[model samples]
Target: MDFSIISENLHYYFDGLLITVQLTGISLLLGLIFAIPLAVLRTSRNFILTMPIRFFVYVFRGTPLIVQMFIIYYGLGQFDFVKFGFGVFQEGFNPDNIGNQTFLWKYFFSEAYFCALFAFTLNTCAYTIEIIRGAIESTPFGEVEAAKSVGMSRTMMLRRIILPSSLRRAFPAYGNEVIFMLHGSALASVITLMDITGAAGIINARYYAPYEAYITAGVFYLCITFTIVWLFKKIEKRIYAHLAPYVDKTQKTAAVN
Candidate 1:
């Protein structure tokens, strides 16, 4: 296959890759922000506290990411109130025909970039919350008792023991979410976001060399995935370093036996 197409369009690919990374990073940050509180609430025994979180998670997790993006970018435009009410950039903002598409509700809900960011963030939050909640539940009862025995208050126990432990335990699953979100950000192209996938699509369209165009995108994706995996491994090693001694001792004991 002709790999020249990729080199010729390197600038486009670079710009697209940057956009993709920006979208993924912002969405992941927002998802973490939302997920933590929702996850804490998810661990609650109370129906009132958990039911809303349950419904939110169910809706987001059940829907396809593309559909969510469409709803945010296209479907919402159908509603006059949503288009005009939430939309800002009032200067020369034509509230009459949103079909002209001036504003998209700035901060995190406007235009292609913000809408894509908002949708992905919500989608990631649903999955991340579940992972974190599971980690929280998995925190050992013995550990809880140990914290209590040390005269640790509930707040102190949560701050010093539960949150850190849960985050450490959840890292692997959360790392997968990061990779998935990065891959999924390609959908931003559907809304004219010009992300990495969009750049690939442009190259393919221009050169009519689908193989060359897509192969480059695939390579970029693989590199990002590997980088994420490496970072996660480093983080896991550092976070779980305390368990290394126990693990090594156990290995030695098993070998001796």
Candidate 2:
């Protein structure tokens, strides 16, 4: 109801929007980089390799994201060992004479940004590994055999044949993941990150205008979602173009003649 309050703090809202975008971008990039190897492991024939990957994916995917964030931030901080580990007391390190030693760790590393990033990265990786595993598995068996027939090594076949094909097939699903990550970044607010949602909450509390603050946050999220969709469309068009049917006019003419 108070347009004046919303207008006054527009810069804060924009800053929060930027923070939200930054978190999503960094987490998505880091998560996918970690996920590829995990996906490959999931498809491994070796039980030793496959079992752990399966367990990791199962546990993360099975739990709620909020619970995971809480455990990483609050739960881990509760342990003396985790807070001040053996590594902190390594030969060259000394905390005894330092003033406010624990204060620095709690303030910087335990901040909501780091905690939310950690949780979201793990959660995204779990989901992405499954998508990648499915795509890799769906690569045609005959193509792999043909690569082998040509004296291709396993490494060569995977590098030259399998990965490219699988990536193309997986693009659509991966695009959906990108959109989901953008929306899910809102959860970072729960950990006290001043992202769009968190900033809106702060503004609403101050002005008692929940409707306007929340509406602004919702608009920011919508903009991000649409932007992701547009970018993915461009990438999909470029990547999948080769898969489209070719007319081959010369071949048709030759057959007719």
Per lDDT, the best of the predicted structures is 1
Report the Cα lDDT for residue 11, model 2. 86
Name the lDDT value of residue 41 in candidate 2. Answer: 76
Off by over 4 Å in 2: 87-108, 245-257
- Which candidate has the highest TM-score of all? 1
The sequence of per-residue lDDT tens digits that candidate 1 reaches over residues 1-257 is 88776787899888998999999999899899989978988988999999999999999999999999999888876765565664544566567674654344444456788889889999999999999999999999988999999999988998899998889999988998999999999999999989889998999899899888888989888888899999999988899888885555557778677
Model 1 spans > 4 angstroms off: 86-110, 245-257
Q: Per-residue error at 194 for model 1, in Å? A: 0.8
Cα lDDT for residue 224, model 2? 86
Q: How close is candidate 1 to the true structure, as a TM-score?
A: 0.87
Candidate 2 lDDT over residue span 146-213, tens digit each: 99999999889988988888878888999888888888888888887899998999998888889999
Model 1, global lDDT: 0.87
lDDT of 2 at 135: 96
How much lDDT does each candidate structure score? 0.87, 0.84
